[model samples]
Target: MKSVGVIIGSIRDNRVGDKVAHWFFEKSGVKKNLNAEILDLKKFNLPFFNEDVAPMALKGNYSTEEGRHWYNTVKKFDSFVFVTPEYNAGMPASLKNAIDYVYPDWNSKPAVIVSYGFHGGVNSALSLERIITDKSPIKMNLTNTKPKLFLSKDILNEKGQFKNIDQDFEKYTDEIKKSIEELEELLNTATANK
Candidate 1:
């Protein structure tokens, strides 16, 4: 079995990213071949890029406690699924911050984008793919999850806790399963070549 890090990209107080992430993991977890876990950005609370050097080549110094914690968290996983919310045609700042904090851990890893927002966060997914491609050897999976429907009502109940609609949940689950299968194939190919 392989372990995948499901990164929840949104850090807003009432964000829908968590709901999406949870649904993705719950479905993926049922597959005996996959060991999935959600990596929430809110827990790290990483500060803005304080390192003088860039993370592109993994040359930067991560001296802060938060930076080290973030790095360690990323190192544990073989692949990633970024659950992001579109913000002004791109991923949220918290997701970018988390990615910027580390480098080599993402190399040779496969990543799938699961985004939700108006227009299904397609712009955000594209933007995120661009960023990841430039720095790491990430095999970006095309089978993504973007709820074309409004998430406000389904993801949040009147009391503010998260909720799920069966239909939308099924779509997300199917996409994640497909992405995972693709990722496994990619990882195997990369390994064989190495």
Candidate 2:
């Protein structure tokens, strides 16, 4: 089975990215070919990039202890699904730092970014798309922004737990499902090329 990393891309307290990642993984885990695991960056305490060279040029030998461990964990996956939220119309700094910490680990691999926020975090997804495109490790398998996963007004309650997110979003859910199906084809093509 191929390991699929479900990345929770936000580190803000009460950030719903982790919840969405868990929900997505629970759903994705039912797939017979995918072994989904949540790769939470919050647990890693990685520092901002301070190495002498870019991660791509490091040849995968990360400089810091946290960086090395982060690289290794990311390397274990065949593909990734980034669950992120927009902050100031961009992705969180920590998520960007996490991506900057590695190079070779994501080469030619597929990344499906699932973002949520007012208007579905489309801006953040666009920002992320540009970042990923400029890099060589991972490729965007699907880039469409369907805000079905958008952080709805009542999505979370007073206690900061999910309420509306667990239910289906009708047509939007179908669209999201279709996008995931496209990943199977992407994986096949990637495997063949490799």
Candidate that scores best on TM-score: 2
Q: What TM-score would you give candidate 2 relative to the actual structure?
A: 0.86
Task: Choose the strongest candidate by lDDT.
Answer: 2
Model 2 lDDT on a 0 to 1 scale = 0.73
CA RMSD of all predictions? 3.1, 2.5
Give the poorly placed runs of model 2, Cα more than 4 Å off.
29-31, 134-148, 168-172
Task: Please write out the lDDT profile of model 2 over residues 139-176, one tens digit for every residue.
Answer: 44553433336666666688766775657333355555
Model 1, position 50: C-alpha lDDT score: 81
Task: Summarize candidate 1's per-residue lDDT along 1-194 as a digit string, tens digits.
Answer: 67778888988878767777777676754245767677889887888878767776544457788898888888887778888888898888999889878877777677777777756788888788888763435434333432332355555679755555555567566556767777677656666788
- Looking at model 1, how many pairs of residues clash? 0
- How well does each candidate superpose onto the true structure, as a TM-score? 0.82, 0.86
